[model samples]
Target: MEASKIRLTVPEGIDPSRVLGAGDGVLRALENLVRAHVVARGDSVAVSGDPDEVELVARFFEHAFREADAGRTLSADDVSRCLAVLRDGEHDASSLRDDVLLSYRGRVIRPKTLGQKRYVDAIRSSTITFGLGPAGTGKTYLAMALAVAALKRHEVGRLILTRPVVEAGENLGFLPGTLEEKIDPYMRPLYDALFDMMDRERTDELMERGVIEIAPLAYMRGRTLSDAFVVLDEAQNTTPEQMKMFLTRLGFNSKFVITGDLSQRDLVGRRGGLADVEKILGRVDDVAFSHLERADVVRHALVGRIVEAYDAYDDVREQRSRDRKESR
Candidate 1:
């Protein structure tokens, strides 16, 4: 069988650097992904391999260049997503690439996966959004970015970040520290996300002025938060009563994002608040629930595979449990 070849011309006035990425990293990634030998010359990229592989490779570059032409810098994550689309034989994803949610300092924050795009859209169109997924799915991070953007745009009067300190479990009384000190560890992720979106001095200033508030979930009790962008992280640790209290606290002109991984809940012998809330409020209007799966894990490449492995294990265990129950 003879090898097939396709050459993609670099459009004038479009930076090849953006399409190729730094040091040809993007090209290399594509080469590793597709069964093709890719070469970049003066003003074109050549893909040579099997006829079928060549066609897919061509489409991949074509999709990526469209994004580059539209002034979006393509990263490894973008390349990975494009590869996934190609393998899945999905149609064009140019719309996903074009939807820039937020830009901070020189970095643009956009959804890298289809699930994440839906998650961000839900946050924008709904008064309450639930991002339920495993780690590295951008559940909390994207919610934080959206919340910060809303506050920066003056769409809301304040930003409130809170999470339950359930890692201590029932032995919380033994923790030797004041209330603030005891909860600081659980709230560090929220603080880190805030600092990522705002400078330390500005974040501190906002905290001092009450424009940005970071506190434990207990701090949210009995307070009606109005005109605020509120995010309750690690909601899986909250009890059903706590979840109801938090949900009822949403006031006029306010948006709430409740994010948690039900699989990672630490609420000993009790159902996760997020799970209960999902069952109760799923059909309610103005509330959206977006779920990200293993494919949405945007951390290291192995993280997605790790999630899949654990999911497989859980399925087997569940089957055994069901079989034993039936036998009884």
Candidate 2:
């Protein structure tokens, strides 16, 4: 059989090391995965193997070079991710990785999947966005990134992060110290993601000056949120009335992002606000909804499988219930 070969030339400004990786480990991974005899030197790479494998190796470097050309460094995992995305052939690897929502320190936050890209785009174009998805799909995290980005760009006057502090009915004031202390635990996740993007000193400064507000959903009642980017996280625990009040609080020059897992709602004997608003505002002007699926889970790879498993179980349970009711 004749040998099939392909040579890739790394762009001028992009270092070959960035595309081919600096370590022998990742270099070997590329060879093993692509099943090609890879010899990388200077600005050029040579892949000689089966025609199919040679093409795979060529595509891998093509994406890696593009990522490097865009000034985004690719780690080994990123290289692997790029290869997988290219192999899937459903999405453009550069497009998914290039629209950076925020960059902090050395970390670049952006959509990892096609669904996430659509969700972020909806958030950008709509006045109100509902991100309904399973856990670990980057719904809340992306919203936070965009909210911080907007605040940095002076597109909004402030940022508001809130969630329902469910205690049967969110009347948690009966538990402990001031309302701040009472709700502090429930607010920890918001604070954690916020501080990740900004230094603790600066985050505290914003909190102290009221430039960034982190409060319970109950606290947001009867207030006008103007010129702000408001994120309501874990909104599935909110009641219909609470959702109404929260949406009505939107003032001029403001954007609202509500994120929740509808299947995980904990609103005892009451309909979840995220689910309720979906039916009402789905067709309303300037309001949008993005439904993310298991494929969008950006946590561990196992998380996507786990979400699929639970979704399957839920379907079976619902079907069984319907069967039993029909037999009566």
Q: Considering every candidate listed, which one attains the maximal lDDT?
A: 1
Candidate 1 residues lying further than 4 Å off, grouped into runs, are: 1-6, 12-25, 31-56, 66-76, 85-105, 326-328
User: All candidates' lDDT scores?
Assistant: 0.85, 0.84
**Which candidate achieves the best TM-score against the true structure?**
1
User: Could you list the CA RMSD of all candidates, in the order they appear?
Assistant: 3.5, 4.2
TM-score of 2: 0.79
* Candidate 1 local lDDT, 189-236, one digit each (tens): 888877777778888999999999999899899999999999999998
* Candidate 2 Cα errors over 4 Å, as ranges: 1-61, 68-91, 99-104, 168-174
- In model 2, which residue pairs have backbone atoms overlapping below 3 Å? none
Q: Where does the lowest 10-residue lDDT sum fall in candidate 1? A: 95-104
TM-score of each: 0.84, 0.79
RMSD of model 1, in Å? Answer: 3.5
